[model samples]
Target: MRKVCCIFIFCFSTYTTFAQNVASVNGKSISSKEFMWVYKKNHAGVTSASQQELADYLELYINFKLKVIDARANNLDADTAYKKEISGYESALKAQKKTSPKNIEYNFIMNEYREGVLMFNVSEKKIWSKVHDNEEKLLEFYNKNINQYNGNDFSDARGRVIGDYQQYLENEWIKTLRAKYTVKVNDDELKKLAKL
Candidate 1:
């Protein structure tokens, strides 16, 4: 009876100690394993990161996730263009000689590719399209900043105008996304990552 009680206690402690998520955005949990995979790959295998470093990366990761969550909310991942582009990328990777097994690296690369495509598509729709498609906004901006343009008309200063407008739009988009989502970081999971 004592042995059974000990086993129950051990199992309960094990279950309580398990933490699956490092962060959650809009109630969708981001797994600790996924965070470790991404962070280690990006930081050159620095698993034993300091707390400050972990905090900094966690903030950056949360920001990235907010954008992706925004993208998902808008159903940007369902676009046919995204599907076609990802399909092409996968085909290209498959056609090339692989250094590792097909299933392992292939899945990781595809997941990253899907996220990249989502970010690009959403950004393009919410930011880049406005700059490229709206001549009126460009003209108004050019007229307002004519002194900076050396007397060039909107046609001649379109390049500079586009760059400035794109930056402004991107800043606004990030601000809106940050305002829209609530990112919750698991301090316990983050501390564990720092110690490791």
Candidate 2:
């Protein structure tokens, strides 16, 4: 009975430690294993990373989570456009899974696509939507940067101008986003990653 109790306590403690949270935003926990999985996958091609490099990557990951949180708060995750896009992606992933159940490459591709969609939805809400809705500003941007446009008429050049304007807006918005989120890294977890 004593041995059984000791084993139970050990198992419970191990499970709790294994499921430890690496970071939290607001009140939501991000698991350490999940963070390490993503970090390792993303940096798999690299031979090694320093503690500083891992820390910098953690900041980027935290910022990504903050943006996702902001998107959820703003109901962007529930938006019809986002829903439709994600639904389409789910269907594609389902088909891929059916075709190749054990394909790591497919799994990585799907993960990349999902992250891309999330980033796209956030950018659409934060930057692209504003640039697209404000025709006057786009026109003004076109006029000021007219020399950069190579077209016979405004109609011909409008698409290029809008694309450039979207990029400009995205850059400015990223700067603001970096300032908006307070990021904290778990130094111990980061050191572990550095050792790996």
Candidate 3:
């Protein structure tokens, strides 16, 4: 019957849409489209990928989405400076691609850029700031690892020392974030992506 056909069509479309998403991080749906964009970009020149590679990318994507969720939850997205930066970056991209606003590529790129800026801002506050704000701790770390620098003074090797400290802070921060947020991966959808 016509009604049966209509119901079947609606159900199929709904399932298709739901299946397109790979995971949900802190209640936000992360679509397979977004994952594909990042995966292809990162794994360029690879004609095909294995299931493990896809799985690894999925884990990385979930962690990144958690960071974005944290950034938005903290209102880091509302800072006027970051707002200006996103606006300027989008404006430049818009000028280059005179496509429809609803264009898939444009939307994906915009989402990536916006998330990148917001995550960077929150990370600066959470990790990088901690590394630079405590001179005593930094000096202590530098002294403890002075041999790593081949005898360079802390002042002369401050940049490298700060980088090493930043990595440590970032790792700890990610562990805390993983404990703070709940991420759900749809194994069926992820497996489907691997088949592609």
Q: Choose the strongest candidate by lDDT.
A: 3
TM values, all candidates: 0.67, 0.58, 0.77
Provide the RMSD of all predictions against the true structure, rounded to 1 decimal.
Answer: 5.6, 7.3, 4.6
* lDDT to native, each model: 0.80, 0.71, 0.84
Ordered by TM-score, highest first, the candidates read 3, 1, 2
Q: Tens digit of lDDT per residue, candidate 3, span 151-184?
A: 8899999889999888877778778888988777
Candidate 3: deviation at residue 57, Å?
1.8
Model 1, 1-196: lDDT tens digits are 9999999999987545446678788877777777777888898877788877877987877877777778888988788987899889888887785833356556767777888778877887888888887999988878877898998888888999999888878778778887888777788888887887
Total backbone collisions, model 3: 0
Query: Count of backbone clashes for each model?
Result: 0, 0, 0
Candidate 2 has its poorest 10 consecutive residues by lDDT at: 99-108
Q: Candidate 1 vs candidate 3: which has greater TM-score?
A: 3
Lowest lDDT block of 10, candidate 1? 97-106
